[model samples]
Target: MDTATHFAMGFGLAGLAYLDPVVASTPALAGAVMIGTVIGSQAPDLDGLVRLRGTAAYVRNHRGVSHSVPALFLWTGAIFVLIQAIMPQAHWFHLLSWIFLAVCLHVFVDLFNSYGTKGLYPFRDKWVALNAIFIFDPFIFAAHLVGFLLWASGVDPGRSFLLIYIIIAGYYYWRVQVQKRMTELVRQRIGKTGTYTIIPTLSWTNWTFVAKTEHHWYVGELISGEVIILDTFTIKPENERIAAAKKSFKVQSFLAFTHHVHVETKERPFGYEVKWIDLRYRSRFQGKSHYMFVAVVYLDFDLTIRDSFVGWIHRGEDQLAKKLDSNRQLS
Candidate 1:
């Protein structure tokens, strides 16, 4: 799940726990304590890399240690030890004192996807069945989707009201995978340049994409089935219709925090290839450890967000192959 969404989920769930005492009369600090219970929601399937590595190999495995209940316990114990060492003044009940509920919340969010997490791994070897959606999908972010909508509508949120927000966000992880596949297929056949990378169009269309091939990139309008090929290397000043990228203050801050901020303006055969670090951990769909907001840079074109990355249409990998076979001159 995206960090912003996670934060929202955490904040909302914590707020809801807080509301428990006030609304349901649970108890004081129950909500705040629930916040810690939610920790490790993303923990269960820490062994995801096993299956991800593929079958038929001793070195390859899924649901290994992280999927084990014992692992979770060990991790929690380690957490407690750290808490004791660092915050001896705090009581054990003080979550910041000796427990890790945030870890549970993390694992909960992880379980909502297709590749379910090992929620009770150490306790039970069964994977929690969450057939609701994929591991990550932008569609589920509909609440995050509706969030901006509600914001625009001037809807203000109160404490504990965050539960609705967390439920929606926890569900958003499933939707991200849906868009991820769509974007991947788009790149699989865009061109033979092999220089392309699927860029996320989160701001424009959640499922939208921009293909950055070696010398070119194409913005696709998946719905209209339109593909426009833009010359990435040949740009003249007269080509004033170039697009502009919207500055995301949050993403920018993340990059800046890691000292990965970069902006380049150089001439290209087409227009410009805005190369910089992809500190934005949007590549997790492609497979990576944690969503590392590390200091790194990657190339993005000016037309990405502007023209909506609508350059060329992919004929599909099979279609591209068939077209190539037909075009090969009979030697």
Candidate 2:
């Protein structure tokens, strides 16, 4: 989930704190629980501080260790101690309970989105992306907003959010069913032997998908139960130049972050340009296809790395090429 949504959920959990008799009776303890919940909700994302280092470092470690099993308990304990220090009169166990719930919910929700977390780290080093929910679902956010509004307007927050959560639970079930149907459509219409990755978009009825067969890559969208293939690329065999490009640290980090990757190599006037596209993300504009997430590496005639760029592409392909050209010249 995005930062805003996480913060909103923190408030929702604080509203839920109204259910506790101790918190409901004491204003100071209630304030302490609110602070504890908000901080606990964002504790795992402290890894965002890694952005100060560089994009490569951020991508490699963003959700890797920070959202792990041990981190959850560690964050809860640290947040509880901090909040308790500020408000000694607050009940220890009640503040700790709300903080722990906030931390656990933060990690649990991240697993449902496309950019999943390493929740099972150390025990199993793999990203657990259900791909059933978008990173920022408007419906989920609206529910939290409405619940908060009602709480602000003097509605009993405990009763209001309780009903909201039940509806949200049903919404999650429906989404899981929709995800299953999308997977079935791909298997029936495309090939069952291949691997299919379903990526949810912000729109409810639309989805993006990347299917890998034995010899080709299929990139498409699912709209209104229809599988609309936007583009296709062949899975070419790698050569020596291509092999050398993957040795760079930037390319290695990209490979570690994603699984559905496509690599292309082209000869340039100065050197060779090796492009890696994460097929899970594709953009279309004005009847053309654009790969949004990519890493471009420029190698000399001898395949020595000269320059590289590994990040998301906001501008069109032409601008991306110009940017790569600029980077190569500076190098």
Candidate 3:
């Protein structure tokens, strides 16, 4: 989820806290709980500070260990102590419990989106992306807004958010089933030799998918349950250039964050340009399609990395080239 949606979810969780009888009656505790919920909701994303170091660091760390099982309890305990010191009148157990729930819900909802968290880290390093929901879901955000409006209009906050959450729960189930159906459609068309990654778009009936078979890769679109292959690439054995490009930290970080990775190498005037793309996301600009997440590495004739970048490319190769040129540093 995006930052705004996460903050909205925090307020939604605070509203749900009204279900507690003790919290409902005490204004001081209710205020304390709201603060705790908001903080706990945004805590795991503290890894976002890595962006200050660089995109490579951000890619390698954001939502990695911070969203793990151990970080959940750490966030809860830390927030509880902070809020407790501020509001000594607040119930210790209730404050701790609500903060815990807030952090848990934050990680749980993140699993539904395309950019998933490493929630099972230490136990497993795999990224758990359900690909069911977009990062910023309007329906979920609107529900929280409606709950706030209803509460301001004299409606019971507890009952209002409870019903909202129930509906949201149902919405999640429907989205998950829709993703499953899209995956099935891709499998039925592709014959299911290898793995398929289906990514949902804003439209309910539209999706993007990548199918990796033993010999080739299939990139396509799913429209109204129909599978349309837009492009196909043969899976080639890794050569020396590809191995050399992976030595760059930018390339390594990009590869670490993506599952359906596709590498392309091109000869350049000075050296070679190796581009690593995550096939999971596809975008269209002016009717032409483009891969979204990418890492570009410039290697010399001797395979030494000279310059590199790991991030999204929006405007196209022209703009990207300009960016790389402006930042290029020779080793």
- True-structure lDDT of candidate 2: 0.87
TM-scores of the candidates in the order shown? 0.35, 0.95, 0.96
Which one wins by lDDT: 1 or 3? 3
> On lDDT, who's better, 1 or 2?
2
List the candidates ranked by TM-score, beginning with the highest. 3, 2, 1
Worst 10 residues of 2 by lDDT: 322-331
lDDT of 3: 0.88
All candidates: CA RMSD (Å): 17.4, 1.7, 1.8
Model 2, 106-185: lDDT tens digits are 99889988888899998989888889999999999999999989998999987888788889889988998999899879
Cα lDDT listed for each candidate: 0.40, 0.87, 0.88
Local lDDT at 313 for model 3: 80
Model 2: CA > 4 A from native: 285-287, 326-331
Question: Can you tell me which runs of candidate 1 are displaced by over 4 Å?
Answer: 1-8, 11-64, 87-89, 96-100, 120-129, 137-158, 162-331
- Candidate 1 on 1-331: residue-level lDDT in tens? 5445555554444444443334234333343344344443343435444544432111122433464556656656655565446534233455442135555555556555433444675566555534334334465455544554553565543332464555666545544555556554666657444422233343323333445544443444344333333222321232222213324222233232222122334443333433223222223332332222221111134443211111111332243234223223211
Best prediction by TM-score: 3
